[model samples]
Target: MNKLTLLLFWLMPICLYCQEDYDFDALLDSTSVLSEQGAYEQCFQILGDLRQYLRENPDKEKLFFLNIHEAYDYTRFGYYSKAECLFKESIQLAKELGDKWNEAYAWYGLGYVTQDKVLSNSSLPPSEEGKRAFFEAIELLKAEGDSAFLVDAYDAQGYAFFLEGKFSEAIEYGEMALELCLKLNDCESEPNILSNLSEYYLAIDDFSTGKKHLQASLKWIKEHPGEIADEIAYNVYRNQADILIHEGKIAEGEQLAMKVLEYAMEHKDPYLLRETNKMLIDYAAARGDYEKAFQLQQTFMSQLDSLHEMQLVLSHDRNQTLLNIGLRDKEYQLLGAKLYSQRVITWSAVGLIVLLLGLLSTVFILNRQSKQFNAKLKKEVERQTKELRISNEALERFAYVASHDLRTPLRNVISFIGLIQRRLKNHNDADLNSFIQYAKDYANHMNRLLNDILDYSKMGERRLVATPTGIDLNQIMEKVFPMVKDDFREKQGILEVGLLPTVYGDETSLIRLFQNLLENAITYNDKETPLVAVQLHSVANGHAVFCVSDNGIGIDHAYHEKVFEMFTRLHNMEQYPGTGLGLAICKRIVNDMGGEIWMDSSEGAGTSVFFTLPLIEVEHEQQSQENGAKAAMAVA
Candidate 1:
């Protein structure tokens, strides 16, 4: 009887553990199915239960699974911070357990959450950490020979690059994912990869390639009906519509676009609806249906505002959810502590007192730390606010200066018009004609000033908001040279361009930058045979300095610094006609591109305008190697 009681006592825990393990496995299977079916609430419930079980059983493998699933559940609800914390925990647990597969998944989850966080906050730049995480996950999955998950990782990385405006890189990764998906006969990701490829190609202005990929995506969807989601199908259709419109197949494109609009409306997806309406607006404008375009524009604006409000609400809800989760965790901890204290007190009152004192100490330390953190945060906020105020004051000063400058042209126009009106009664045709021309010139000057001001303001905003890409200076010069070739021809001047390097910048801005400099070089010359030369001045420290030199009526030393100021001219309008905004615009563009521009000249000496641009190192090196090889071949 004694042996039987001892055996049962020992066997009881083993039996319970086995039963618990079985239940855990079943629950995990259920969670997987529920997750696949998009029943995230049920998945979360199971995950919570598993979390509680793990607290008691302490199974590393089961804990990793619980963290991963719960992290994904939180992620789907936009609780990114929670998801990130859970993913990090899973990563650590997976590493401890030497589970490469789950470790790869945990890294992938972390990267995906990071990507989501960046996407949610437009102010944030593309995440390098996210990219590194994805790379780690991909390498591990490759080592594990897990091609299925590898496809997802590749697709995700491609999408991340796409969001960052790295279209070429995006295309490269998308192609890899597509090839793998095709080889594995994985129809699930094929359409998505193809659709994404189309967008990437289109972004780089490879319309034919983009159209081909769009068609392939559509065909894939047609062949694999129900495999693709409704959202994906509509997105593919929208791409097709955009391509067709670009191809001038207006009727067909509009038809497809209308279909997408219907789908968006039916689904009540504000983003899709606004996008479709914008496309329709463009279509209407193209067809010269201004009324329809206006109506669509109104609708698009309304949808945009609604979408912004929805985003705000979603953000608030996510923050609230995080707060509630924290509160619940604290409540659980307090409940557990209370129960522990009760059990300890049952054993010994003295031990209970010690436990209570320890709890109080922890709480006091945490409260003090929280207070310090709050104080630091408050100081940081105040510092930022002061900086913002200074920036705003500077902007106000700029506005005041701009308005003051603008009034000069207006006054000239008014004065000239009054003179013309008074002289009309005197029948003075020559004076009247001269006054009219003067008025026209001032009005034209005002127009030019307004356009330049707009460009300056827009460029500043664009520099802050737009994603820059690799721009070949050679290509930019090709576009810019043609624009100023007429000026060169008229002056009968020689315009020489040296070999240019590729740089990281906005294409349009770069083109404008060169155009302004080249035109300035040609326009400012006083010599009979003006010589304008564009040459690579120097290259060092990942920057290329280019010099645009001109045998012009050079700027005086006294006026060199002032020349870049807005509407500051060295010469009169009659001698050298301009808004004087050229150098100002050039300076703004150079500064915005993280470079400097300055002129080296005396009054009679030829001016050399030197500017720096960030060099695309790989491209510059390749070019140099090619040049070296050519030189060797020439010697041979």
Candidate 2:
């Protein structure tokens, strides 16, 4: 009986090992199927379960497959960083296991993820790392005689080249992929390769060759309907429409393009909608339907704007997801540390039973480790905070550049509207003229809004570069008065000055600050004879406070704070023709100069704006004068 028991115990582990292996294989297969079917949630659940199982069982081979499957799923979900990390982990495991095939697969996955990462983050330069990874993958796959994956690798390389605008190189690799796919008798990827080839050829203006490839791709899809996705087939058809239009088959192309547009609308695909709308616009222009063309252009621009807004939202979500992932990683690290501590405590308990000295040593080690972990965590938090600040600054710069670029198109639109108005001047159609005038007005308003946005974005950048110097408020007021002198004179406004003092700040910023305040005082006033007063409020703590009070229309207490916000307006543009950015800009300038600004006013009462600026010390002023004199004497 004892001998039988020993034998059964030995057999039991082998049986359990076989059963575990079978279960792992089944889960992996299910995950692959789920991924293929686009059931990513279920796929991820299986992957997560597999990951946990592998963690306990410690199977590197199984872990490698798990990482590969999960990585691809993550890539599909646009989590490029997570995918890249998993691919890298897979590569390490493959290397340890001496599995060249899987290693090449991992490298290919890394390259693919990197390509997407670079595309999504346009600020990043083209990724040579991705290219290098593809090359490594190709070489490895070639050595292993894996033609199936090699085709994908070649296709990816071609796509990368296409993205970089290297058309010829793209064609070269694309042909290689097509040839390999043909030899392998794989019709599955053939249509995709042909479609890509068509695009490549079209890029180089080889219309005839491009059309041939496009036709071939369409034929393949038509013959094997289920092989290609409906979206892909529609895209292929859209490309055909583009070619047809380019070939001057306007009527036929318009018909097909309209169908594709319908499909795009039904699916609500922004990319497809934009492309189809763009093609339709061209079609309208070609047919000499200027009115239709203009309307289509408007639609295109609106769609483009919507797409941009969506992209921004997606970008925000992506950043939030990445932050969450980072936090989760940190949490996992903490959990691991806790687990290690628990193990250490359990060991220490054993040691305590054996020797109290061992337990004491363990306690000391734990204390030191806990301090080190805390210090590391603190450093990490600081680093992340700094990175967040940099990211915010970058976003500000992006906003500035985007708003600036938008002005060019807006200017063009306004110019076109002006041309239209001039051309229609002779027609004298009242309704048409009124519509044109409305368009012109709206365009002008948009222009003003964009200009304000640009100015607002520039404030932070100027603050970073501006050097503070002793500035004479009296001189600043003199310079500012002229810019708004016409308005004051036109309104018969009286500007009173009460002996302004010199303060330390950027001269230009100070000039703008007062100009904005003075302009606001004059513009917002409902009084027939507007009276604006600049007074020295106080001087203390090395800073001087100044006030600009207006005897015009005053703001309500509820809107006192709101008035300082960008784009905030108490009245319509018709009543007050000014961008609401003036006060906001003033606030930013004051804050940048290490001061504060506030308003004291009530509805229908005169308003008072108070602001502060640093005061130049007497010693510094005298020293500056002496230095200036010395320079003048040396120059003479």
Q: Which stretches in model 1 have alpha-carbon errors above 4 Å?
A: 1-22, 28-46, 121-127, 258-293, 321-636
lDDT of 1 by residue, 1-636 (tens): 245334433443343434334456655666666666655544554465456556667888888887887787777776665678898898899999988998999999999988877655533343455558888899999999999899989999998888778888899999999989999985588888889898888778798999898889988888878988998789888889889888888889989988887787665566567666876787789889876676676566555544654664455454554444444433443444445445444555455566877666655565565556556545654664565445444443454456456767776766777676676756757755664565566566666765676676566567767788898776676667668777877888777766677788888888889899988988989899888877689998898999999888888888888888766777778898887779988998888888999989988788999999998844465564454333223222
Clashing pairs in 1: none
Shift of residue 442 alpha carbon in model 2, Å? 6.9
TM-score of 1: 0.48
After aligning candidate 1 to the native by TM-score, how far in Å is the CA of 257 from where it should be? 2.8
Residues 231-287, model 2: lDDT tens digits: 778878888988998888878987898888778766556657876887788668877
TM-score of model number 2: 0.60
| lDDT (Cα atoms) of all candidates against the true structure | 0.73, 0.77
Candidate 1 weakest ten by summed lDDT: 627-636
The TM-scores, one per candidate, come to 0.48, 0.60
